[model samples]
Target: MIKNGYRNDCFVASVLLTLYANFGELGGVEKLFRRIGDKDITAWNSMILAGARPGHGSSHSMQLLQELCQTTLLQIESATWVAVLKSCENESDLVAAFVDIEWKDDSSWSSIIGTYKQNDMELEALGLCNCKEMLNEGVNFTSYSLPLCFSACSQLSAICEGKQLHVLAIKSGYNRDVYVGSSIIDMYAKCGNIEESENVFSEQLEPNEVIFNAMICGYAHHGKAQQAIEVFSKLEKNCVAPNHVTFLALMSACSHAGYVEETLHLFTLMLDKYKIKPKSEYYSSLVDAYGRAGRLEEAYQIVQKDGSESAWRTLLGACRNHNNTEIGEKSAMKMIEMNPSDHAPYVLLSNIYNAEGKWEEAIKCREKMAKIHVKKDPGNSWLV
Candidate 1:
């Protein structure tokens, strides 16, 4: 086409750019992009999507959008931002894109709202959720939207709002939905309404593993470990086969209660009786259990055997909590060796030195971090 002088056409060039980029020909895309005299939103969007692929700068899409926003009169659409979100690594950035969208459908709203609530932006999530325009537009209030809103209220401990939603659920007939029912249980428990959570649990009909998991996890979170154990025992009696998540919740209960013997017994049953493999997260949880119980050596040995970065970090944090400098230093060194680029182990190791008043050692650790250019991320705290 270029040989036939179709290269003079911006539309053809833009289409060629997209095709080439989609075919993994970045070079061809760049060539066609350069030949186009005037790049418009379509051409820019294609280029941004291409750059957002793996092994490319994840921020390139955002950079292109910024350029387009400054240069073009074209209105940004839902597709454009959704494409940008494909490359977003953090929820905060997603929120940045989300707030700019002038209009969206149910799926878009549900997706962003759920994501916002997940990233601890309950306030922002709920704000959009209750946006009067959305309500006026007659957005569907199905199971999807209700759970996240309830979750936000629960997380914020907004019991009055949660009850309001429960009322809404009853009126809307969403309370019977399994997903909504589970979220309702979780919300009640999170908001410290144990009685309400229990009532919801008892009222559930033909509940699945997820609902049972929610109830057990809620009990575990509230320090009612024995109750959690009782719930686990009831699973078999109810003829519901427990998944690994069920055992994780049950093990977490034992761990929280400092029932070391019981925790170990459950771990064995999870493997031999239930035929479940101990994932890295389960190992980390086990390490946490021992660490919290002042059983440092046991935790350290388990972490050492597991050899997962997260497990080692968990053990290291436990050492820090217990003020066990020796284990902390060792764990920190191992973690740094495993992933030299991460700032967490470096910061924690330096803190361990500082905490022990080893000024020279602390200075050395700090210097190493500086030399490696590993900048510790600033800490963030969320109210809800």
Candidate 2:
């Protein structure tokens, strides 16, 4: 849109810059802003915001913010201040450098709190929260920012801090807020407080698919497959259609519990009922589940049907475990045909032969690999 010479309207250009920045196309955003010729404070604010958004590296954003501070003669606005503060929060070194700078309002405080939270500096985030409370200075922190602080505490497994943040959130009437509630549930779950996670989920005014997925993943990851399945069932009862992540969680639960029959059922349902095609991870899990159960034929069939290198590799791993040379050779051959340059199959095949005390065969395989120039690269261990 900026390419068509529509840079006259600052508001339109600001919106465009925001969109580009959100999408990580910062270069395009800079091009448009520079073409405006007479850059306004709003344009500068937009550029700062574009740079400070999460997932955008803080170093580059900080550099641009410093340049703006040096070059611009205009008074710095609150928005620009917030963006720069946020960049500082994202990087701890910057936070220490900017700590003495006086922030005019709660937004700037929130930005600092969010940065500490995002960087997993739990104590720092909690300390700032306490400072806000001590000020009692009538600055109402935004509902959105507190959850990030709680998330930090959760990451650190600081349950006490997380609970304090939870109380603050409720007192501030943000308990029922979907985003806040989801973060709280996730925090509790991540901290291994499953009961607290459930309590938070139950209290939510409107739990979305994301919240449901979080709970499901939490249960699956913690080896509570039955609980994960129950949560998934409830999600379905609530009319929340499962997405790709939903299936992945379900597969994880099944794989963990070695519920081969259930895994097969869910895999079929994912394709036929939900119309969700299997991803590489899903296929790999299927192969792993079957292979672990000593069902080599079933594992091979899955790899053949999926045609994924990961799936084939899973079968090869199983063959190694069971000492099934016949199937192992077939799997290795198939893998080489699919990706001849990959050194994994050759190494795995050679290992399989060595395990069987077939040293001659192993040497022959190594000779064949050398002829094909398929040498193992340093630091590329097959185990990982």
Candidate 3:
């Protein structure tokens, strides 16, 4: 349609551009965007939206925003700002883009706070909960806002802050909202307040998969394998089918508590009963269970079959944990084969040799790292 001089029709071309972007076909959007000569606000917004799609990040959208500002006399609008804000991949960039908005609406404010929590900038997310500008603008908290606020509080272990949010959630009558309920459960569990988490879980009139998953994950984090599995059983009894995330949390709980048999059984059940394809995280947890049990051979077989670098790294870490020199050497070699430029395999292999008191082998591993020009990262730790 665009090829038959429709590109000259700015309205038609812009519609085509918006349609392409809506379908996540950035290539078509780019082609349509370039063909238009004198673009208006709608055309610019469509181009910006396309750039904001996944894989392109915010680079293209930000570039277009700057170009629109410098060259075009048209003022940037709210939709454009929101598109750029949504494109931001990290907390700092998200903050910068958000502050560029001429007017902060409820949706834009929600995006900013949600971005903070999504990026794991918990302290910042918590701080955003009290933004004076947003408060002055009468931007009220919604169901979406409560979850991230609770998540940040949970992560920072700000029990006082969490309590405040809990009060707000109840007073606003959103406490029973399934997503809010799940977030509350997650926050309490993460803050080492499992009792509070359980209370919230029990209060749910009808829990969804998310609520069940959160409770199971809470138990897993607390190393309460019995409780986690028991929750899974409850979910099954309630006829709430488990998803991939559910299985991941369940397997992790069993792995951490050394329930190797249960871990394997759950993995089998996930494939045969639920028909969930094994994601890398799932395979990694299963491999970790075997590795933690010092079953190096089984771990190796699983990682190789799974074909994930992170899973292989887990197996390698397990080798170091159990001091299995032979399997550690094999894992190290395979990791190097997979990613020659990565420093992890070299560092892990060298540590394994050092742990076993094989000084020569350790020195050789370091030499190989040096030869490959993959500098080992400096040792660092935080006082948590």
Candidate 3 lDDT, tens digit per residue, 1-384? 656777867788878987888888888888878889888888888788778888878878777877776677776555666677667786567566556645555665666677666656789889878744566877767888888888888879998888888987887788999999999999999999999999999999999899999999999999999999999999999999999889999999999888999999999999999999998998899999999999989888998899888898999999989988998888888889999999988888888889889999999999989987998778788977
Cα-based TM-score, every candidate: 0.64, 0.69, 0.74
Candidate 2 achieves a global lDDT of: 0.78
TM-score of 1: 0.64
lDDT of 3 at 329: 86
Worst window of 10 by summed lDDT in candidate 1: 96-105
Over 8-30, each residue of candidate 2 has an lDDT whose tens digit, in order, gives 67888888899998888989988
The residue-level lDDT of candidate 2 at 239 comes to 87
Cα miss at 381, model 1 (Å)?
Answer: 10
On lDDT, the candidate that comes out on top is 3
Instruction: List model 1 lDDT by residue over 177-201, tens digit each.
Output: 8899999999999988877998988
For model 3, the superposed segments whose C-alpha errors exceed 4 Å read: 1-112, 115-124, 131-139, 381-384
lDDT of 3: 0.85
